[model samples]
Target: MSLVDSLKDIHLSILPQDPVKIDTFVFRLHYFWTVSFILVFSVLLSLSQYAGDPIDCIHDHNIPDDTFDRFCWVEGTWTRKLGFDAIGGQMDKAFLRKDLNFVRCFDESTNSDGKPHEDCWQHQYYQWVALVLVLQAGCFYFPRYLWQIWEQGKIQSLVSGLDRTSLIKGLQSKNELQKGEIKDKIQLMIQYWREAKGTNNLWAIKFYICELLCVLNVVAQFYFTNFFLNGQFAQVARQGLNLDENDSILPILAECRLTTYGSGGQPQLTSGLCVLPLNIVNQKFYSLYWYWLSALLVVSILALTLRILQITSHDMKKFVIVYFYRIKEFNDVILKRSNHGDWFLLIRLMDNMNDVVSSLFLDELEKIKPFEAYRADE
Candidate 1:
């Protein structure tokens, strides 16, 4: 049978056709989005580690303005990007400064720089690396789920016509088959049904995995939003703190004007480059809110891991036998008995059911051995 054309054989009518199509499409889209989100999440989480520190934005005499507006996104706000300094002194000391593309460096005169400084860098790098590794592992983990999905779809399509074919053949050949031959054929058909059920379970795993990816993507988006809205902006300007040693403001107003507008003085448009919203940053940061979010993320990760284990533990090989006979209509296949001449067909059907059930039971028993032992001990 042609690969694509064969799909029509499976009777998927029990399911709303449009919903299944929509669901399949959504699953595919989610798979793509999940992988993409993981990569982006890793990068952002790494960046956030560096940005998390509350670096003094106040340098020289001037209070660094919206240089840390970028942190607002990480803090959970998506309102607007932080404004950059119109003057020369930028908030370069802040690790997440729009201009600082690398790790933040310490100046000898900077207040936070000294013996304890090395620890800061170490913590920052470690957190960044850990989050990046998480994203990398997720990349490797998702494919097994996708493969299970493909296998299930294939089996469903292939098995749809097998039952009718077998039943029709059996009825027509009923008078010709010897008793022994009829018994053998029936046993074979039973084996096919067992195999089909196993195949159905394989598709279940794919469905579970697709759901997992969707949840992960949504969680990442939530964290991204939180980090943007609540994160601290550096109070210092790029060129020191705009102050003298005595915390005195140098007469620098004539040199630069502090306005909410851009260099041209028109309302600075930062939306094109940065997508964070800024309106939420002014709200009070609540520790409980963060705790709740962190808990949710942890729970999501655990749930996904459990689902993965469940999917992988499934025996894909079991489905191979199920699809072999390719029976689609279990109810339609009627077991027929003929005169002694037709006894052959009746015997075959009974034998097929017996052999199929026996083999499946044996296999299932093997799978339950470990669990059974544990239960017994308990």
Candidate 2:
């Protein structure tokens, strides 16, 4: 086998048959798309930043020289130390030269005079945001992992057995010997499930766990977006979209400060506001955050709705209705069949019903009266 096929075999051997694959909606939205988007976006963003220098000098003619730009590059990426002077509102270079003391942004520290403080890097913001997105992707997938851990093995085994049974009984040969073999196989499958009582109750528990995880994932996303993204992007997007009052407001992007200090400072740290240059990148990051949050909200709603329907389909009332419906359909087949066809139809119905209701309907089938050997027409 090729390397690709070998890897596929290894993966399948490890995971076997994952239960989450049975729920295509949840698997696609939560497990596949959500995780893929965040991680991919993070990688792209990191690559873009790494490929090109994140800081560049402004080409505005109003400034006297490139001193401010050079100072910013040396100071740090996020420090906003070079803006309008407090004494004179004008942002000219002369004012900055005289009154402005450009210190590296550093938080307050209790160190003695002349002690060195840590230098803050501007690219750290991008790094932090990327890390957060990667973490959120993992969080999004955690529930699916929980489901697989708790229920995947049993679900895969059951599904595999049903598939094997269907393959064996679906053969088109008309031989009496083959028909008898199919009947015996069908009877054995029914007896196996009948002996496996309370499996339906286990399914109910699994369904409930799936439902709870769906809701929890949604709630966690909202909380992480609001608090973890610094709420800046979400707030701005809401305002742009004219949303109602929301308590989770984001911090001002430009006004945000990082602590750094100059090499010769009195060991006293100072704060610098993020410059306008870095604010552009911050805006883009937050914009993407808003888009991701909105998409996640919609997908979570649809996935949760689908999960509820799947769970409800297994309830007692619905189960009884489906059971009777299958039986009535099976009886209709008996009216039009010879002895051989009747046996074939019965096994086919059992196989079809197994996929739908599994052991629940099979146990019910065991309680029902056996079909007559003679055809209805006879």
Candidate 3:
């Protein structure tokens, strides 16, 4: 299927599991789902490197074609620097800045002594593209590992066996053992929360920090990819538009030299222009990659900021119960007496329960609110 269809499947499959997840959807998008896409693309790109000819060359009469192609693909390729004098007409292009086109090649850079200027080797990165992408996948996956290490499944443990009890459905399917176990878990959570006070905020704060890291990671990937492409990646969209003989940017034909032995064991150096079909593919692939990353950065930043906004709501815990369970008439004392961590925990617990249990959970908090408030007054 198409790439969009492939991405759609990944997106949908992860959407339903968000509620069950201990972390946010943004976290899954970076470490899990995005990693899957990059690795798959890396594998597909690697096939062309091994199974197909990465470069083709037309050599001198004596130098064999296969030998030249293999030599250039392995050794390296070079691009010439074109000064503004050569770019006389097309100076309007953004890529033609003085920093860009350098070292015109062996022919143009020859001095009065008949020597070429400093050789600028390019396209070595093309050979290692697959490995580089794998490294990038690792970058995205690291934060998840860090968060998991710190988390140690704390949220999961706190709300353990929440779904197994009859609280979700009706009293008919009730198992007293599970019911009591669920109650004990909730009771322990409540007691721990009441005692812990502001201490529990660390759990939620750690999660938020990881979410922010995902956004920062996206920004870093842009620079890394551009550097890998020899500064061509960021300008691909612009340089790509004018793909002419003089303005060859993404898949520019590169010059390669191969030295072989002749009859008297004389070393003969031959040069040829090698065609890199891989760069053609890279230009398009990374164009899509760039756009997708740009969009991901925007979404991730917004999601993180909006989440923080939700948490800052004055009546966040109370609002959760009222919005989900429509419980308009309930004791608001629990909210008045609750600490940041208590609100953080209660809302998270309620997130996993159904409306019936959520209202019941609200009621349990309501029963405690008055006594907690009364004790605080004393």
| Candidate 3, pairs of clashing residues | 80-103, 81-102, 81-103, 81-104
- Report lDDT per candidate: 0.33, 0.45, 0.66
Question: Residue 70 deviation, candidate 1, in Å?
Answer: 26
Point out the higher-scoring one by TM-score: 1 or 2. 2
- Over 247-275, each residue of candidate 1 has an lDDT whose tens digit, in order, gives 10111100111123556766422211122
- Candidate 3: count of backbone clashes, pairs at least 3 residues apart or interchain: 4
Would you give me the overall lDDT of model 3?
0.66
How large an RMSD does model 1 have? 18.6
lDDT of each residue in 41-107, candidate 3, tens digit only: 7766787789888888875657668877888888877665322235355443423452233423445
Error of 3 at 339 (Å): 3.9
Better of 1 and 3 by lDDT: 3
The lDDT ranking, best first, is 3, 2, 1
Candidate 2 lDDT tens digits, 1-378: 975576457445533553323443544466666666566566555555566444444332333224444444445343223333557766535324422223233333543332333421133344355577777778777767776676545434434434444544644332322345444554555554445433445544554566567657767777766665444445556544322111112212221222335577533233333333333444554556567667766776776665455334434223333463343222332223223222222233344433333333344344423323333335
TM-score for each prediction?
0.24, 0.50, 0.71
Worst 10 residues of 3 by lDDT: 94-103
lDDT of 3 at 56: 89
Model 3 error, position 29 (Å): 1.8
